[model samples]
Target: MNTPDTHSPVLEVQSRRRPLAWLVAIALVVLAIDLGSKMWALAELADREPVRLLGGALYLSFARNTGAAFSLGSGYTLVLTLISVTVVGVIIRFASKLRSLPWGVSLGLILGGATGNLVDRFFRDPGFLRGAVIDFFSLFDPYGQVWPIFNVADMALVTGVALAVLLELTGRRIDGTRAVKERKTAGPGTRDKAEQA
Candidate 1:
């Protein structure tokens, strides 16, 4: 008569749950910051000249973007909105497989950023699913002549994507495992011991 191995199962469950918790917490924080910044920009920067900062390296100017990131795909607000919705759905579907802290963080940033812009598409001015996104941060030029005006959501999306790409290139799996490369044996007759066994 031996005691049961209760600790293993409990630890496994906690490991699975921890990643999801991090994902949700990070996503909520990103969403809140994006929304808050947008609100502040709308209230304080409206109808005002661009506020220069960092010796003109950055400018805070209000802008309503009717397009995707970097002001691309203008005149296609509805299509862009649909695309964002699809992205959010995909992230949610993938969340169930999250078992790595880094993957969780990457997905969380993407989900939060996508949701932030989606909110604007649904609730901002000019009607539902066709509303413009509030943008305030500008680089180099105030009128967005040098660079497109952007917001916090765009920043998060870009950062998340870059991190995800880096993780993939580094062979970091979503299950917290490092991918291993298989080595080939020299010569045709050289069979590996494992294969022979």
Candidate 2:
């Protein structure tokens, strides 16, 4: 059985290196899986029809997307690549500041996903920084064009961002500190006007 954590999140992060490892490990693993799956899709199924993975609900289909999510901004591949590079750079610059588990994991996932796609942008066809990202894995086909086809990297990116949003909503700071609201107390013997009466 797991014991109750008596230490605050910030305290726990400060006391251990394990959380930092978790952040790096998650990023590495996510990057590996995302890229590995993309490689497999490229070699095995690029030209073939969508391979049904689980009934009609999921499929593995090959596509080289030159744009952002849902194939948006298809004409600006280089611009998107530059933006991705900036994002990855910014994330790495702040990687050392990750202290909260949720934030670490969130950033890790985002970093990994960003790196994964960025790799394709660097090396894939159609010249440097203009290469298309290889995506597969279609879902919810029964709904009929309701869900955009995506890949592992995309999955990580979306999940990480969502978790980050939730953490922010609950007043969890990026540095593992809880955002506590300070009560307004009487200061230096000063009192409210009604209390003075």
Candidate 3:
């Protein structure tokens, strides 16, 4: 009884609920993989010197960042935790509004990344809400740490935000609707009269 036609329109049913579930699934997966990698890094590379890879362009160095990405807000662990909580909350709110596939992908990445970092912020080290994030991957050493060491979650966050920015520039909304700009038009008679006169 199954046919190709039966499987065709699977992507057509763009309900918000399904996409929201997708978002949650992505978040859980990202959180799991990110945390798992961090654990592996801590166990394997915590005490070792940075291991060069790709001819020293990339290296594995265990770092504990108590602040925002690249240790920017070192003195604001609690504040960053609060901001991350807010990021998670905002993404959850947006999940229920997703109807477009692009929106779903972008929001899912954001949600996943935010949750991944939040887990570290809440349970990694020093104390609650003051724990440091585990960063291990460093890139472009010849460039003098120009890239600022980051983790998988940070990469996801940056990618997601970039996609969102592109979507906004393309006049697409999160609800699967296009923001078409209306242009002014003149009546046929008026246009003709003006031309003729």
- Quick one: best TM-score, which candidate? 1
lDDT of 2 at 149: 71
Better of 2 and 3 by TM-score: 3
Local accuracy by lDDT, each model? 0.86, 0.78, 0.77
Per TM-score, what order, best first?
A: 1, 3, 2
Worst 10 residues of 3 by lDDT: 188-197
Query: What's the lDDT of the predicted structure labeled candidate 3?
Result: 0.77
lDDT (Cα, 0-100) at 157 in candidate 3: 82
- In TM-score terms, candidate 1 sits at 0.88
* CA displacement after TM-score superposition, residue 52 of candidate 3 (Å): 0.6
Point out the higher-scoring one by lDDT: 1 or 3. 1
Per-residue CA lDDT of model 2 for 1-197, tens digit only, reads 98767577865656345546777888899999998999899899987877876668887777888987556688899998999899888877876666677777888898888889889889989989999998887786622265777788888988988988998787776656676545568665543221100
TM-score of each: 0.88, 0.81, 0.83
Candidate 3 global TM-score: 0.83
lDDT of 1 at 182: 51
Where does candidate 2 clash, by residue pair?
A: none
Encode model 3's per-residue lDDT on 1-197: one tens digit a residue: 85545224664454656766677777777778888898899899898888889998898888888878766778899999999899888877766667767777788788788788888888877888998899988887622266777788887788888999998888777777776544448654322111100
Q: For model 1, which pairs clash?
A: none
